[model samples]
Target: MGTKMIKSSQMNSWRRLDNSARIFPAASSVTTANVFRLSCVLREEVRPEALQQALSDVIHRFPAFNVRLRAGFFWYYFETNPNSPKVSREELYPCAPMNRRENEGFLFRVLYFGNRISLETYHALTDGTGALEFLKDLLCTYLTIVHPNIPLLSGWLDKPASPNAAVLEDGYNKIYKKARGFAPFTRRAYHLHGTPLPFTAIKVVHGVASTQKILAVAREHGVTVTAFLSSVLIWSIWQEELKGRPSWSPVAVSLPVNLRAIFDTNTALNFFECIGVGMQFNRSGITFEEILKVVSGQLAKELIKENLSQRNAYKVRLSRNPILRGFPLFIKNLVLRPSYRMGELTATTALSNLGRVELPKEYAAYAENFEFILSPTESNAIKCAVCSYGDRFTISFSSNIEQYHIQRAFFRYLTALGIELTLETNYFYDNKPVASPKGRKHKQ
Candidate 1:
C-alpha cells in the first residue's frame, strides 16, 4: 500500500521562485538543459513496481518537489501539481531536456535502469543537497518495502509524516542583508573549443577510485578534496589547451557552494551560489604544486561567510528592485537569456564536489555506490561532479564535445599518482563494450 495523497486545497497554490533559481526557467534550452542527476547503484536489480510504490509513498512528504513550473505575468512560479508523477525506465541519454507536458507537468522525473535508481531534476526545483535528502528517504522507504523481514535500526529511516514549513522557505530571502558593494568582477575566462557531438548526444565518463587513497593524496598536498580536485582540473586545462599558448584569460572553474552549510536554513529549494576559482598560466614551466597553492589560497578567501553573504545579498537586492520586477515575462526572458550566456563565459568549466554521502549501516549492505552528474552547456562543453559513498569515490565527467583529451588527462594524472581508477563510459560505437578494456578492471 502507498501513502495517501495530500489534497491540493491543503497546500499553497503557488509560490515565487527562489533567488538563485529565478534565471533557470528563462535560460533553459535544448543546448543547455540546466538539469542534474543523482543515482544510487544497489546490490540487487531494481523492481519497477516496488520503486513506483516507493515514489508514491515518498512524493507527498516533500511538498517543495511536488510542484510544476508555471509562467506568471511578471515572473515564473511553482504551482501545486495535482497529478502524480510516474517513474519510468531509463531509455534516453542522462540529463536530456525535460518536456513538462510529456512528464505530466512535473519538473523532475524518477528513473531506473537495472541496479541503478536515478533522480534527475530541473535546476529550478532544488539544489543537490535537497535532492539528496529526497533520494535518501525514497531509498529508505523502498528498502523497507522490499526487504520486509530484515531488521533495520530505528531513527535512521524515520522521517516526519509531513514536511516542516522550513523546507519551502526561500533561504536567500530570509537571510538577506543590505550589501555595501558588489562581488569582485572577473574577466572572461578561457572556453573549451571542440566539434559538437551530433544529434544532441552527451558523453559520460565516470572514474571510480578508492576514497581513502584520494583523501590521503589531498592530505599530502595540504588541501581539501575539492581544492585538490580543482587544482588538478586547472592543471589539466593548462597542460592540454593553454600550456604553450600566449593568452590573457585565466582557466576558471566554477564551484557551487551549498549555503545551507553557512546559513541557518533547511529549505529544500535552490539556495546555493557559484563562485569562480581561476589561475592564469601566461608563463611556461608552472608546476602542479604552484597551481595547488594558488587555488587553495583563492578558495580560502572566496569561501568566507561574510563574502558569500554579501554576494547573496546583492543578488537578492537586484531581484527585488521595483523597476526590474515590473517588466513582463517575455521582456525579462530576452534580457536574462543573454545574461546567462555571458555568465557561462566566465568559467572554463565547472567542478562540483558533493562531498561524502552517508548511509545507515543497516542499509549500507544493500547499496553498491552513488554518483552525481552535471549537465554540460555549449560554452562549457564539459562539467564534472564528484561524489563518494563508503570506499567508492566517483568523479563523473559529462561532456557534449567529441574530445576526451581533458578527461584522459584528469584520470591519468590521478593514476600517475598511484591511485588506481576503474574507468567506465557510455561511449558505444561500432558495438564496443561500455566499460573500456572490458572486465571492469582498474586502469593503471
Candidate 2:
C-alpha cells in the first residue's frame, strides 16, 4: 500500500530459532497448539481480494514471519517459504493447531470473517509484539487500498518500511550475560479440573469493558491494570475451583513480560519472559484486596530489570550449552517434549497483557476493536490474553474445559465492582444456547 517494497535478499537462506522459540516446536501438539491470535474488528466487512493483495505486498517486509519451520539435525530452524502466502476465510475454530503442509509451509495464517481480520501465528515465529506489528501493517495496507482518499493523521501507517538487521535479530542472544544462578524452579501449582471438550476443541469467552472505567478502578486499588486483572483471575479460580479443596498447591498465574522495552531491542523474535505470580491459599476466607496486594508486590519484585536479566541469561546459557546443542534431533525432541510438559505444571494459568494498541487517527475511525487470544494446553486448560484499543479493553479467555464457572465468576466480580462488561463467546463447548444474565449481554 505504501508503493515501496523491501524484499529479503537472503530469501532462500535458513536461520536458527531464537532462544525462547526453541521450545515451541518441541512442545507443539494437538492439545498444546502453541499458537496465538490477534484480531481487529473493522467497521465494515473485509474484502478478501484486497486483503490477499495487502498480505502479498506486506509479507515481503517481514522476513522473519515469512518463513517455514524446518527440523534440523540438532535443532529447529526456519527456512524461507517459497510459496506465496494467501488470505483465507475463517473455517476452523480460533487458534487451532497449525498444519504447515496444508498452509503452504507458512507458520502463520491471515483469516477474515465478516468485519474481523485475524492474524494467527505459531509461537515459534514471534511473540505477540511481533505479530501485532505485522497485523498493523496488514490492516493499514488493506485500509489504504479500500479507502484511498482518507488521509492518515499519523505516521503509524508508514511502518513495515524495511527489514533492518535488528528486526530479525535474536534479542535474547544479543543481550546474553553470565549469571551466577538460574531462577529457582517452581513447584507444581494447583490446577483447575474440568471435563475436556471433545476433539480438542477450544471455547473462547471475551469480556469487553471500558478501558477508562477499568483503569480508574485499578488506580483506586493502587495497582497496575495487569496486577488487578490477575488478582481477579486468581480470585475467580479460588471461588470456582480451589475454595474448599484440600490442596496446598498455590494458584499461580503466569505473566509474560515483554523484554523488548526492558532489554531495549527492536528484534521481532520471541523476546518475552514469563514470571509466575500467585498465592498459596492456606485459609478459606482470603479477600481480593489481600490477593491484590500480594500479586502487586510480587509483580513489582519480579518485573525488575536486574532480576529478569539474571533469569533470562540463565535460560540463554542453558539453550546454548555445547552438550545440549550436539544432541540429535530425535533425542532433543524426546527430551524437550517431556521437559516442556513438566514446565506447564509449574503454573496454574497464563495471563499475557499486550498493553495498549494504537492506530492512526484516520484509520481508527474504521476499526471497531481488537482482540488477543492465547491457545490452551492440556495441562493448563485455561489461559487469558488482554489488549486495549481506543476505549475498549478486552480480556479473552481460551479454554478446552466444559465448565464456564471461572469465566462467569470473573465477569461477575467485575460487574460487582461497578464496571460494565459485554460478554461474547463461541458457544462450542456445549453446542447449545447459553443464557446471559440480566444487565450483561452476549454478542454471539
Candidate 3:
C-alpha cells in the first residue's frame, strides 16, 4: 500500500515558482564557461511496469517528486497538469532524468525523458550522495509494487514530515555557513596536439552489492576502491600511449568528492567540492599499488580538513551574489566563472567514482547494476566515471588525449593483476580537433 501523502507546508520552507519548471542559467546557453558532465547506467532488466509502480508509490512519499518551480523556492503538489508542466524527459536529454520535482534546484536538474527512462541532474542541486538515497528508496518502492512477495524494510523508508526549514536544509546551511573559509581549486591543465586519440567507454555492471562489501574490500586493502581503480585508470592511459595512441603525453586524473557525508550535514544543495588528483607516471618505477596508496592518502586528508568548505563556498556565493544579482544569470556566469580549475591532463582526463550504493536489503535483489559518468567539463580531453556493485569496481574514463597508449597500458596492468574489468565504448563525440575554448566572460 502507498504511504501517507505529504503537504507542501508540512515538508518545510516549501515555496512555489508560478512559471514553467526548467533549470535555466546553466542550460540557457551552450557557450557558458561552466561545464556540467552527465552519467547514466542502463540496466538490462528494468521491469517497466515495476518502474512505473515505483514512481507512483514514491510520488507521495517524496512530495518533492511531484513539484515544479513556481518562482524560486520549492513547492509541493499532488500533481501538475501534464500539458502545462512544460517538463518532460526531453528537457533532461543528453542528461540524466529528473523524475522528481523536489529533486529540482538551481544546481540540479532531474527529468525522466527516455523510453528506458533516464534520470539526469546537473551539479547544482546536490551531489551524487543525496541522489543515491533518492534512487534507492524509489527503486525499493518500485520493487515492492512489482513483486509484493519482497518484504519492505520499513526502517529504511521515508522519514515522517516536519515543518522546520533546517529539517530539509541542514547540510546546505552547514556548507553555506562554512563556505567563507574554503580555498579556491588550484589551476591545472594539460595540452593536446594534432588529431586527438579516441578512447571509447563501456557501461559495465554487477548485480546488487551492499556498500559494506565495497567499503570492506577497500578497508581490507587499506585503500579506497576509488583510489585503487583510479590508480589503475591513470596507468591504463599511460600504457595506451605506449601501445596505440603514440601522439599523446603524460596526463592528470580528476576525482570529484562529496563533502556532505564527511562533514556530517545532510542538506540538499549543490554541496560537492572537487579536487584534481594527479600522479607522476614519467618513469617506469611507478606501480599501481604505489599510486593507489598516494591517491588514497591525499583524499583521506582532503576530507578531514575543517575549513575546506570555504573554498567552494565562494563560487556559490558569487554565482548567486546579490551584487550582479540583476544581471541575466548567463551574463553573471561570466564574472562568476572560475579563473582557475583542477585536473592535470597535459595528458589527463577525470575519473569520478560515486562508490557503492546502500540498499536497505529486503529489496536488494531488484537492483541489477549501478553505473556513473563523470561530468563533462568544457575541455574535450577530460572524462571521469565510476560505479561499483559491492567490492568490484566498474571503471571508465573520458579524454581527448591524443595518445591511447596511456589508457591501454593501464588496462593491461589490471588484467595482469587479475582484476576483472570489461572495457567498451558506449559514447564518443568523434575525433574533433582538440582546442581549449578561449575563456571570455559573458557581457551584461
Candidate 4:
C-alpha cells in the first residue's frame, strides 16, 4: 500500500524543491543518506524545555524551514508542517537517515549534547548555506531564551531581510539563462574502495587549526584558503595512492559553491552547485606547487557566473521538461538514482567550506566553535567540511570506510607544514592514532 500523504490541511501552501534539491528524494537510501549538519557549541549546557520554546519561536520566522516532504505522481514537494519538531538529546551518530516516519514527517532534526546544539537536515530541505542560516537563528533564539540578560546586537536574533517571499524563492528560476552552453560533463575519477565500517557507522576526525596561520600560508602561496587546502587534500590522496591506480585515474576534490553570492537573492533554499577539481598524474608523483596551481585555476574558472548559471540552467531545464515532468514518481526515481550515482563518479571526495561565522560580540563569550559536517554518501566514501569561528578554523573529515589512510595523511601533511593541530572524535576509542600509508601510525 502506498503511504498516506502527510500535509497540513489547514495550511494551503506548498513549494517545489529547488533545482539542486530535485534529486535528493529519488537518490536517498539507507546507505547513501543525503544530509548535512550545522552545529553550534555554546559555553552553557543546553536546557531542553528552553531550547524547544526557542525553536518554536524561530520556526515562525523561517517558514521555508518548517516543511514536510511529500510524494506526488510527478515529483516530490514540500508541504507545511504544523507538527512541532521533536527535540531530543544527541544520540546515535550524525547524518543518520531521516525518512518521514523517523523525523515525525519533518525533513530536519534537532539534537543537543551537553553544550552543543546540532541541526541536521536532509539536503532536499536546503543546502549548507540555508541550513547554516537556520542554525544561526536557532542559536540566537536559544541564547536569548536561556540568558535573558545578555544583550543581543541590533537585529541579531531578528528575522531575515524584507520580502519573506525571497526567503523561499526558487533562485534557479530567477537566474537561469537558456544558453546553448551545456552543463559540464563528468568523467570517471578515482574512487576510494575498501572494507566497510561495521554497523553502517560513520567515523569523523576533526583537525582544528589557526585560521590566521592557514590564511598566511595560503597568502604566501598566492592562493585562497580553499585552493590551499584542496591542494593539500589532492596531494595527500595522491600520496596514499602511491601509483597503485591506472595512469588515467585522477584525484578530484568536489566543492560546493554558494550561489547566494553570485545570484542576487537571499533565499534560504538550495542555492548552490558542486564543481570538481581534478588532476591526473604519471608514474612520477605531482608536486604541491603544481596541484595548487591547477586547483587555483580550476576554482577561478568554475566559480564564475557564466559557468554556474549555465550549469544550473541545465538542471532547471531537465526538471521542467514537459515529458519528464509528466513521468510518474516511480519512473522518475529509477531514472534519477542511476544518473545521480553516475555523476558521483566525477569526484573521488568532496570538500565544502562554509567560510567564516562571526557571532555578535555579546554572544562571543557564550559560544565556543561551529562545525559543518557532510554526511558520507554511498559512492563517495569520504568527504570533508571546513568552517571558521573567531580565530579557530576546523576541518572535519567524515568517512564510512574502515581504512582512514587518506584522512591521516591529509592531517599529517598539514602538521608537517608547521600548522599546530588538535584532533577530536565522536567515538571514544577513535582518539587513538590511525595507521599511516607506510604502516607506521601516530597520533595527531
Candidate 5:
C-alpha cells in the first residue's frame, strides 16, 4: 500500500527468513504450497471494497508481512513488496496452494465471502501468530470503516507507520548457541493411510465447543489443554488402526511451540519449533487417562525453554556455517527437501494450538469466532489446528484424505465426556443431513 519508493540505503533491508522457515520454500511444489490460513467469521456479510482498504492500511502497519520470497545463491529471502494484497471473493478452498506469481509476487492473500474473511499465507512468510495479528488489525480497520464510532482495541492492533526493526529480526540468530550434537534420529511413526481425494481436494471439518467445558475436562484429567486434546487424537487413530499392521510403530503427534515467550523477541516472522510426543499401545488396551499421563509428561519435558532454545540455536548455527552457505540453491533443495520430509516421519500428524484470542467487547458484535487451519503434508495426510475466541474454542481438522474416521472418533470421545460439539464442513455434498454422534447437528 505504501507507494513511496524505498530509499537506496533501505533497498538492502531485505531480510532472510528465520531458521525454522528456511525449509518451506525448498519443500514447496505445485502440489504442496506449505500454506496455512486464518479466518474470522463475522455476523454480517463482508464488504469487498472496505476490506481492501483495511488490508492496505494494515499492510502499512506490519511492513515485514509485505514481502515476496526470492531465491538467492544459497537461501530464500524476503524482499519488500509495496503492492497491496488483492481482496476478492472466496473462490478456492481454505489453505489452497498459493502461486506467488498470481498475487503480485506477494506470498500471502486475503479473501472474503458472505460473512467471513480469510488470510492465507505461505509458511515461509510468517507463522500463525503473526498472521492472526495482521487479521486482528485488518478486522479492526474494516469495522471502523463500516461501523462508525466503534471502540478499537488498543493493544490488539499495531498502528505505527512502520513496524519496529526488532519485528524483522531473525530471533534464531540472536539466541543461537553452538551445537553440542545433532538431533536424535526418530524411527518412523505409523502413517494414516486412506484413499486420497481427487484433484488434491482438502476436506475441512470444524468442531466447536465451549472453552470452559473443555478446560474443565482437561482439569479433570490433570493434563494441560493441548495434552488432553492430543491424547484424544492419539486414541482416535489407535482405535482405527488396522488389525495385522505392524505393532512396533508408535502413535505420534507433533506439537508446535511458539518461541516468542521464551526468546523475548516480538518479530512478526516464523519463530517456532515442533517437538513430537508419542506412545505405544499394548494388547491390554490403553485408556484415555493413561494416554493423557504420557502426553502431559512428554509435553512438560519437551517445552522447557532451555531444551527448545538449545535445539533451535543449534539449527541456526549449522545453517549459517560458511561452508554450508556456499551450496547452490538447487543442490540445497535436493538435500533439504528430503531431510525435511523425513522429519515428518517422526509424527503421524501435527496439532498447532494458537491458544486464546482476545478483542475489545465492541469488536465481538461484528465478529463471531476465529478458525486456525493447518495445511496437510504429503507424508502426514491429516493435521489439526486450534484457537479460542470468547467462550468458543474451534478445532479445525484438515486433510487430503477423504475419510473422517479419526475426526469422528475424536469428536465422539469428546461428546462422551459431556463436551458438546457442533460440526461444520466445507465439503459441498456433505451439506445433506447425516447422522451425528449426538441426536442432531448443532449450529455452526
Candidate 6:
C-alpha cells in the first residue's frame, strides 16, 4: 500500500456530489471502535519468510490501502493518497505494540504453528465479518501453496480478480453513502488503565459437525447466533455490575454489523457500522435465555433498519460538521474527541461475531478449525470476538477490563448449551514465554 496523500482540498473538489447525500449518527461504523480477528491453522515449521510471503500475497489480492481516516472522514479510491505519510506498521500507529495496544496493524507473525494460528486487528479498518473473510482466503491460499495435497472444501473459493465470479457479498454501497463523519465523541485514544485480566486458550478436540448444528442451536429458540451471543454477553455485564463492587450500576455490550449487507462495495479499508445493544439489568432475575429472547427482538429490528448503513453514519457525522474535509486530523481529533465519549455510552463491552467464515468443502480435511482473537482497546472496556470453524467455536476476550469474572462466567454459561469449550490465554511476562498455541502435542 502506498502513502495516502490526498488532502481535504483535493477531495472536496469532487464536483458531482450527490444531492441524495444523507446524514447519520456521528458514531457510525468506521470510527466506532476498530476491531478485527484472524484465524488460521499453521504447520509446526512456519518461518517468518513464509508468513511474510503469505501476508504480501494477501495484500496484493485485495488492495484498499487508499481507505483511511483523513481530514476527519473516511475515503476510498484506487489512486493512492499523495498527502498521507508513508505508513510502516510501527509508524502507522502512535501506540506501542502493547499500549491500548489497540491498533490492529499488519501481521504480528508471532505464532508459527502446529495446526494453529491467530491474529487481531483494530476496528478502524473493518468489522469482524470482513476481517474473517480475508483471513479465510489468506489461510486457504497459504494452505494450498504449503500443503497442496489437502483438498479444499466447496464454497465460493476462487481467484477474486476473476471477472465472472460471485465475490464475497458486499451489499453496503447500495444503502450507505460516503459522508464526513463528524464524530462528536472522544475516547482517550489508545489510553488505558486498570490491570488486564488473566486469560488463556481453552482446548477441546472433536469430530466435525455441520453449520446446521451450530445454526440450529442458535435459531432453535428463534434468536440468530449473533443476537443470542450478544444477549448472553449483556447479561454477563449486568452480573458484573451487581456482583462486582464496580461504581457503575449497569453493564453494556456493543457489536459491529457489516453495512455491506445493506449496500455493496469492493474496497476493504473500513466499511461497516457499529451499534451498542445492551440493557441495564439487575442480577436478581438474570438468565442468558431471557436476555437472548429480548436481544433477538432488538437485533431483528437492527438488521432490517433502513438507516443503519454506512451512508447513514456518514450523513450523521457530516451533519455535525459541514466543513469536516477542511481541517487537519489533530484539530478534528481535538474537536471531535469529547463528542465521541458522549456517544460511547450505548455499551460498556462489545461482542463481535465474525459470523461464519465459509470455507470450501475440500479444505476441512487438514485445515482443522479456525479461531479469532479479540484485542484490548485503548479504552479499558472489555470485548469478545466470537467465531466458528467447523464444529468448534472460539471466543477471544479483551484483557483490559477490571473483571475477568465476567469472561469466565460468560463461557460457563455457553457450555450450558451442550457445547464444550477449551480456554487459552495470550499474554507473557518479560521475555520468558508462557506457552505457544502449538505448545501442546500436535493433534492430527
lDDT of 5 by residue, 1-444 (tens): 553433434633687788888888888875576899898888898999999988877776776677787888878888878566778787766778878777888888898877888898889878888888888888888999899788665765545564456777787888777757347337898899987876646778889999999999999988889999999998888887643233678889998888898889887888888888977765545676887898899999888887887677668777877877898989989988998888888899999999998767788778888989888878889999999998899999998887878898889999999999988776533356543211123221
lDDT (10s digit) by residue, model 1, range 1-444: 554443456565888899889999899999999999999999898999999999998888888888888998999998888899899988777899977777889988899888899999999999999999989888988998899965756754555655566788899999898876475446799999888886557888899999999999999999999999999998888889875465689999999999897987878999898988888877888889998999999899889999988888888898988988999999999989998999898999999999899977767789999999999998899999999999999999999988889998999999999899998887753355666311132211
lDDT of 3 at 237: 53
Better of 1 and 5 by lDDT: 1
Tens-digit lDDT string for candidate 2 (1-444): 343333555556888999889998888988899999999989899999999999998887788888998888888899988889989998777898998787899999999988899999999999999999999989998999998987754555555556566787889888888876476456999988898887757778889999999999999999999999999999999888966454589999999989998889988888999998998888877888999999999999998888888888888888878998889989999989998988889999999999999887767899989999999998899999999998999999989888888888999999999999987777732555543211122232
Model 3's lDDT to the true fold? 0.46
Model 3 clash tally? 64
Model 3 Cα lDDT, one tens digit per residue, 322-405: 655566545543442433222222225666677666565675554545555443333534455667654545554434333344
Cα lDDT tens digits for candidate 4, 31-56: 88898888888878889999999888
List the candidates' TM-scores in order.
Answer: 0.94, 0.94, 0.66, 0.92, 0.92, 0.67
Cα error of candidate 6 at position 322, Å:
2.7
Better of 2 and 4 by TM-score: 2
| Model 4 bad stretches (over 4 Å) | 1-12, 152-154, 158-163, 243-246, 428-444
TM-score (C-alpha, index-matched) for candidate 6: 0.67
Candidate no. 5 TM-score:
0.92
Worst 10 residues of 6 by lDDT: 16-25
**Shift in Å, residue 16, candidate 3:** 11
Candidate 1, superposed: residue stretches over 4 Å from native: 1-12, 151-158, 428-432, 436-444
What lDDT, from 0 to 1, does candidate 2 have? 0.86
